[model samples]
Target: MANIKSAKKRILVNRTKAERNKAIKSGVKTAVKKVNAAIEANDKAAAASALVAATTTIDKAASKGVYHKNTASRKVSRLAQAVNKMA
Candidate 1:
């Protein structure tokens, strides 16, 4: 599909980057879900731990450009709020 050599190289590079980004996004989603599940189960300690993990993952994703900085901050803030409310 890519005719030019440069285009072909770009395609390869993009594919690699896409896979990496997908993994990071998946990690972020999983962490967030874990936090939400803990919160729903009324396990404050678990929720707090999950919140820390999720926030760390989200910050990492944002720093790596997998997510927008403001979006990551908002998510972390909301998650923290939810966890805090569990007490």
Candidate 2:
């Protein structure tokens, strides 16, 4: 429990930010799963489309500070590699 007024406000703000970050992370996971699912199904077209969506979501998450830029780039690269390997 925060006693001071400012501290209490900070707690509330932190909670809100945490929830927002959690949602962004969840979305990123879902997008990545979609890409993986398409890849597993051996559907090149679907996988390509899913990769696009995943890349966009990952880039956005990185820009928003939910993920580090290099980390996001690595993820995108790996997913792209997997999709390319399907060929």
lDDT of 2 at 21: 91
Q: Using lDDT, give the best candidate's number.
A: 2
Per-residue accuracy of model 1 over 23-77 as CA lDDT, tens digit each:
9999999999999999999999899888989999999999999999999999999
**In candidate 2, which residue pairs clash?**
none
Global local distance difference test of model 1? 0.95
Q: Indicate the residue-level lDDT of 44 in model 1.
A: 90
Which stretch of 10 consecutive residues in model 2 shows the poorest summed lDDT? Answer: 78-87
Q: What TM-score would you give candidate 1 relative to the actual structure?
A: 0.96
* Global lDDT of each candidate: 0.95, 0.96
Regions of candidate 2 where Cα sits further than 4 Å from its true position: none
What does each candidate score in C-alpha RMSD? Answer: 0.7, 0.6
Find the 10 residues in a row with the least total lDDT in model 1.
78-87
